[model samples]
Target: MEINKFIDHTILKATATEADIIELCKEAREYEFFSVCVNSGYVPLAKKQLSNSKVKVCAVVGFPLGAMSTEAKVFEAEQALKDGAEEIDMVINIGELKSKNLKKVEDEIAAIKNVIGDKVLKVIIETCYLTPQEIVIASELAVNAKADYVKTSTGFGTDGAKMENIKLMKKAVNGSAKIKASGGIKNLDTALSYIEAGVERIGTSSGVSIVKELKG
Candidate 1:
């Protein structure tokens, strides 16, 4: 199934160093994974490292926490794209969503998408913090905001992606947008399971091992 193409080689830890990103790009180039996901600050370095390769650069905005102001998220996304990020994975404001501020949640996503026009926008709904109904709501909100993908979690959350959540998201998006299952996906079996459930992307730090497992 060309599983490597479905993977987004990721390293978003706060403790990640220059060497770590370099090695990440190196591995991404070697393994020929789809893209390398990093913090906005590392977009330039990742872009530089990945130059001349087909592997794209994806930058995270609002990161593991989506509490930042929408303007802040927009600026982060703009700067990441200016620095060569080909795709943006943004976290939605969980607090606002829980407050039932649906407009705010949808507006925040739409605002970011407005700036990144045509550059891929994947909304990270941080599924761990939401209820089943909330997951569906967030997924629909992402679709309403015209996001390219609806992502499950941030991995830093208390929990990660689950099959039930994937099904909910699938029904929620209704094919208006694609789905990305991130967090806690660390093996070939788990990744394959998500793909089997219809996720278009797999965001994980275990892309190396997962691809190796598939190759072997």
Candidate 2:
């Protein structure tokens, strides 16, 4: 399969520089990745670098920690879109979800979606921090909130996406939304395994390496 299309070439490290984002867009164009995921601060640069390319600019909202207020997340998402982000990967309020405040979690996602309109919204459930039941509940909440995808991990969590979590997310979304398996997808085999497990997207910093492996 042409796996590059399924990849969201990502670089979300705390120390990422402007040069790093430029190179990311360059590599994304070269590899024809589906998108280049970056921090919100670099959205304009990524958008400029990728202006004439099919590779989209995706911005992360609430980032590694989703403890921010819903207003903050919504504003972040709206500004990212204005800065030219075509897709948004937002972290949910994990604390609320754990507290069984499902409505709060659902409203937070819905509020951001309301501002973005037709722009794509991917909810990062950070599966590593959740139990099986929590994963299911989060997935359902995302679906109900009109999220386009239920993403696994932040790649900043204790662990990234696992096959088991992918399966659970898939069953939970039940076709209500797509699945994006990020974190720990370092090679071709693991990437494909997530796809086979029903993930429609792969978020990783190793997209170039994975494609190189595919070529070899």
Candidate 3:
């Protein structure tokens, strides 16, 4: 199924040097991945490297933790776009949802979506933190809030995306939102399996490895 197009080559380490991101963009260019997902700070550099390539630039917002205020998230998203990011994968506020403050959660996402209009927004629910019901709720909220995609994890959390979670997300979303399963997907088997389970996008640092696995 042309797995490279499904992959979003990721490198989100706090200690990642500029050379690291440059190497990442080179790998993405070589592999022809759909995009290179990086921190907002690296968007311009990655953009420079990926110039004239079909590969897109995706930046994370509110990142590993979704506890930031809506204003903060919007500002981060704006800065990322200004830095040449074409897509955004934002983490939803889990604590707010768990606390029955769903309005706050929805409004936050909606606000970001409004500001970033037509620029893809992948809402990271961080599946590991939510119950099955919460997953469904989050999916519905994301869909209703007009998010383009409902994603799985942040890779910094306890666990990465699971097939079961993807399946649940697929059913919960009911085609209203696309699914992007991120984190811990290290091999071809898991990557393909997530696609089989209805993930439209994949977020992982192991993009090249998985493609090699696919070649095998």
**What tens digits encode model 3's per-residue C-alpha lDDT throughout 23-137?**
9999999999999999888999999999999999999999889998889999999999998899999999999999989888999999999989999999999999999999989
Residues 1-216, candidate 1: write the lDDT tens digits. Answer: 799999999999999999999999999999999999999999999999999999999999998899999999999999999999999999999999999999999999999999999999999999889999999999999999999999999999999999999999999999999999999999999999999999999999999999889889
CA displacement after TM-score superposition, residue 168 of candidate 3 (Å): 1.3
lDDT of 2 by residue, 40-112 (tens): 9999999999988999999999998999999899999999999999999999999999999999999999999
Runs off by more than 4 Å, candidate 1: none
Instruction: Output the better candidate (2/3) by TM-score.
Output: 2
* lDDT of all predictions: 0.97, 0.95, 0.93
Residue 185, model 3, lDDT: 89
Q: Total clashes, candidate 3?
A: 0
Q: Candidates sorted by TM-score, descending order?
A: 1, 2, 3
C-alpha lDDT of candidate 2 relative to the true structure: 0.95
Clashes of each: 0, 0, 0
**Total backbone collisions, model 1:** 0
Q: What is the lDDT of candidate 3?
A: 0.93
